[model samples]
Target: MYTPAAFRQDDLGELHRQILACRLATVVSQGPSGLQASHLPLLLEPGEGQFGTLYGHFARTNPQWRDLAEGAEALVIFQGPEAYISPSWYPAKAEHGKVVPTWNYIAVHAQGRAEVFEDGKRLLQLVSRLSDHHEAGRAQPWAVNEAPREYLDAMLRAIVGFALPIEHLQGKWKLGQNRSAADQAGVRAGLAASLDPRDRELAARISADHSAEAAP
Candidate 1:
């Protein structure tokens, strides 16, 4: 995460909020062979010293976790909306025509120890919490036990639950914070004109960052 001071987000609460918004993340680990990564829907435990405690599971047959992490440290990347910013959007292009394309996005990287194991009860708790958190709005909300008992049990056996207690966290909110106000305004307008929903969403975040900065 090569975040300049302007793009750096030091607020832990905001970082956690963004992480929760994007529940799924990529967990990377290193081992004797080399580096390995797995994409998993992780649950964060938020509190004091809780910024880094993440819980997730992978298929037991997925050797990536076992092969790469023997309780070694890992990095979990929680990504936010992202979009492309055309150089043409910058007002500077009209003056010096020296503007170049850039990307606007938000992401959080959490480094911590990887506890790779399957705890059945812990897995059940995690899945139940995930279900409640994500499916809270459904008319007929989904529950973990909607499946047959035997089937669910066997299915559970196929997966291994794990946690990564974050030792450190870094966040990058590259919403053109380094740009001049005029360029930022142009980017906002350009992104608002884009068709991609992601572009709009990322642009909104960038806008919010600017708004917060302007507040007394």
Candidate 2:
């Protein structure tokens, strides 16, 4: 993450919030063969370690977990709201025609050595917690115990759980902070006018970041 000073996000709480908001993460690790990546929905334990701990599972057939079992450090990426910002949205484009197109997004990177396990009890608990967290907002939330005991046990055996206590966490919020206030406002206005929900989300993030910056 090559973050400029203006885009750097160092607040631990905010970083954890982003991770929670974007539960699915890209886990990258180096194995005996080479680099491998896995997309998994990770649960964050915010108070577990200096930064925090991440809990997730990989399919038993997935070789990436084998790498983690052998002590490979992992890099987990949590990507948040993002949108394409046209140069036309910047007021400076009209003033000096110097602006170029850019992307506005938020992301967090967590790095640490991962601890892998296949114990059925721990795996059951991990899956249950992960399920409950995601299902909390549903009208008819499901639970692991709802399924037949044998089926649930078989499902749990098909995956391997891992815990990574984050040693280093970095967040990057590239929401046009380098641009002039007028340009940022223009971007917000342009994005808010779009029908795409993602663009509107980015607009809201920009507004929030700007308000935080202007706050006393």
User: RMSD of each candidate?
Assistant: 3.0, 2.7
| Predictions in order: lDDT | 0.81, 0.91
lDDT of 1 by residue, 1-216 (tens): 798777888898898898889968998878776888888888888863656588888888877678535677788898999888999998888988977888888999999876777767777887788788889988989999887988878877888887777788999988877777888888888888888888888777765347423211
Give residue 45's error in model 2 in angstroms. 0.5
Model number with the top TM-score:
2
Residue 163 in model 1: shift from native, Å? 1.7
What are the runs in model 2 whose C-alpha is more than 4 Å off? Answer: 208-216
- How many pairs of residues in model 1 come into backbone collision? 0
Top candidate on lDDT is: 2
Mark the 10 consecutive residues where model 2 has the least summed lDDT.
207-216
